[model samples]
Target: MALPTASLLAPGRVVPPAPLPAAEVARAAAPFGQSTMLPRGAYQDDQVLAWEREHLLDGWVCVGRSTEIAPKGMRAESIGRSGVLLVRDADGALRAFENACRHRGHELLPCGGSSQGTRAIVCPYHAWSYRHDGSMIGAPGFREVPGFDTSLYSLKPVRVEEWHGWVFVDTSGQAPDFGSHIGQLESVVERYDADALVTPVVHEYDVEANWKVIIENYQECYHCPSIHPELCRVSPPDSGDNIELEGNWIGGNMDLRTSAATMSLDGHTEGTVMARLDEVESRTVMYVAVMPNLLISLHPDYIMSHLLTPISPDRTRIRCSWAFPAEVVEREGFDPSYAVDFWDLTNRQDWAACEAVQRGMKTPSYEPGPLAPSEDGVYHFTQLMARAYQGQQA
Candidate 1:
């Protein structure tokens, strides 16, 4: 039977999805294999994102690599709606502050912008000047004001810390201590000597999907054989083991095919293996997701990172960078095209899948699904998120 043109041409309407229910939240936190996916509202609701911005991500979010800002350099970053300023002082110490000037709330540096060799942070609005350490230095037409103390007007401080060459900022002052937050990840990756490595390539992606969707994609290889043919050729889809750890993180490793050398397009590398890697470490790739916003992939010859910035309910911005040992990067005729191209292609594939999921979730018939045994990593992460929601409700 042929459908009428008028019926086909009519616009279809969809009712807005409801908020997450307590029952579903409990179901998502249930034991692995028994648990189902998080409720659709977790990904589709603006209110859920607002709660996450204030609780889950406001504290100890990874902003960028420490190497990006040189001595006397300053960069502006954002955590949800709040702005942050990262500074490398004259003494080479790293610091962070609220991006606003102490005088009139004007941003010292534009978001997503960087300044090098800066001597002072001067406000464009009122000419308030601050030193590299965030101490007030100059205040035009204010020194003589009654009881106006320069000491009391320094830029607001934000807790900053560095771990394995990555910079993290805590705006809420309520996150667990940095050490406890990092937990056993330090001992797990210490052999890589990540602090001594240098980043040589970075790529940004604006994905039309919830941040959690992208993370769920990274945690499991269930889709690798279908979407990432190149990756599957270099590493078996089933050759993975999830690690149990004590921290606000989740991770595991996958063994490389004996025929493969590294995770490049051709499964080979001209780069030298990291000096501290043992035999097993040299042949495996480790994937780690630090809570909130950082994803770290440790390879034998290089390290790759993905920093997530949630833009809206269905949008995220990702910063992906590749880091290699200094000696390997400085080698004559050294080229990183192999690694960069491989991941760039893989990343696009993942983004496409995440976008599809986002679109599907909006359909009226969409329902939460069960997790496969291979999806334990995803299950672990969802459990954490579900528990967080439960705690907030309580």
Candidate 2:
């Protein structure tokens, strides 16, 4: 057989169906403050989605919680155009592999389910089985076939990592070390004891907007005073500041009001402060962005996470979860209703704003706008997107 071309193996290398004009491309490559949005087509075009799936989404994404796939558990998720399987082996180690059969390219495991004590992964089509480590275990009958080697046909593997009980997978298998990239985050968040926290509340929303709109809304609070009255009452809009990092992460801090102990509806904590936090730490809210898909907000009493998933050019899914100390949640009569209710209202407000922006972008008069001084985080995010879409690794 003839050798495959580089373009065949790396889809990102192929020319985009609808490429951005040269002038717009140059604008995107400029510094954060100097950069502006890509053309409106970049947000509503199918060709742009195809290019993004290959270059951006293939890098790394936070899929689910570690507890969801404990030892001997198996789950599947859609990454880009391919389905990926996440499995915890009998040894309690997590691994990710492509979810296709070696023989006929049929889907091996279903999208969501427990392995049910399955010893080996058997393909439903041809009964080809693979071990937990992705080694070929058995094939019914192939002894007479020429040049057939079971050793060469083991299942393909993807990169998976666990951080603070959250599971992340890299489809391209080229992502940098997770810890090395965001290790500085521990200095600011170690006091929160995130490892001891358990997520008990989750909110799912399907917004009619591009994924970038959601991320931009999150990185800046310039609209908080106008949109989120309750949020500004606690963490004032002007009280926030961000620090750009060298790795695939961004860090920032916002000071809560003097009388506020937490981010509840009334700016008070009904429970005790989080473990190990000093006086100042207890009154501040920290924001961290783990590039490509994860955003984390740490409070003195709890932690909140936003996972952005793109469904199409103009549709995105937002998964938000709130986690508190395991002991706090286990206590009887403990209600987090205040915090939940406060954020619930605030989230819907932001989602509405994003949807409105999406609708505006479809108009013929839409044009890229300049960034405000306080919207530094949005600028950084735009820079990252521009780099990735232009075939540069982020």
Candidate 3:
């Protein structure tokens, strides 16, 4: 059925979908963000899939959680729409795989790779085996088979790394190295030193909305003033001059209500957290939502790590973690929940917005609308998605 669009469109926004003469794909998308917004399902189109496979998947995908996996071959899954295995090697290095067995691709078949310890991954169906490094190690009666080259069936390895104790995995292998890509975000990361940290509380949610809607919710604070009363109390969204956003999110900054010079991972509300950021938790708060699925949020007393996973074009899963300085976590009377109220509340507001949009998009008027100049970050995301589909994969 032709979904309605008039209801979602702004006052005099998108008209009916009149087909346009073909032009360059980038130029075609120009109208979506510039003269008009994209039509409904732009987020769900097959062409968009083609673009993501080339640009996004080829880019870095975050797969980081340091303390979740134990020292002895621990395994954890970041179920962000996709099930990615976060595995720690026997030697402590973190590795991620597609969480499958070569024999009929079952996720449950394993003997040595179990809850306690993992010496090897044993498949139940055909007994195929793989090493921690993602190499295939065993295959039943392979020596007697004619075309049995076990070397060809290695477990596909995804690029993985740890930053401030957070483990990150990239399925696209095309993303710059974790260290290099993070270099662009050094100011916030260097301030937090999250790679060496540990999370005390983990939070996850399944919301009724598209993943893009959730991302747009995270990127801007324009709605903070009216919706998040507590957030406005502690850190007014209008006062977002605290942390400056670079690249696509330029001009915007952390809108902490205080005039503190900087914030750190530990949530300290004073000092030059951005300077000499090697070790001190001098500043009080910081936030960064990396492309695709990860958000790095820092507060004075703790840190909130978010992983945005898409269950489908319309549904999303948000994974959150609360990490603190190990000593503080070990201390008695340490309450991470005290710091969580602000984010938890803010997230609720965002969720409401996401649901509203999802419901509104079902109306026909939502197609090809206008852009609010203040929404540069969100608009940029749409543009990037469109541009990614413009060319053949480079």
Model with the higher TM-score, candidate 2 or 3: 2
Best by lDDT: 1
Q: How do these models rank on TM-score, best leading? A: 1, 2, 3
User: Candidate 3 on 232-335: residue-level lDDT in tens?
Assistant: 66554544432333322211345444443323223333112332343334333456666666777765545687877665656777878777666666777666
Mark the regions of model 3 whose C-alpha exceeds 4 Å error after superposition.
1-38, 44-55, 74-84, 108-116, 141-152, 241-252, 259-284, 392-394
Error of 2 at 95 (Å): 0.8
Deviation from truth (RMSD, Å), model 1: 9.4
User: How much lDDT does candidate 2 score?
Assistant: 0.76
lDDT of 1 by residue, 255-347 (tens): 999998889887999688899999988999999998889999999999999999999989999999999999999999999988999999999
lDDT of 2 at 19: 55
Model 2 over residues 1-394: C-alpha lDDT tens digits?
1111111112334423335565675686576567677667778888888777776677667886776676777888777778888878888888899999889988888764456566788888999988888889878888777888889989999988887767888788765566654556657767887766888888988999988788888888888888888888888788866864445666578999987888878897756689799977788888887766788888889888888788998998888888888888888998877678888898899999999999999888888877777877776676666655555532
Poorly placed runs, candidate 1 (over 4 Å): 1-19, 392-394
Model 1 Cα displacement at 26 (Å)? 1.0
What do the candidate models score in CA lDDT, each in turn?
0.86, 0.76, 0.57
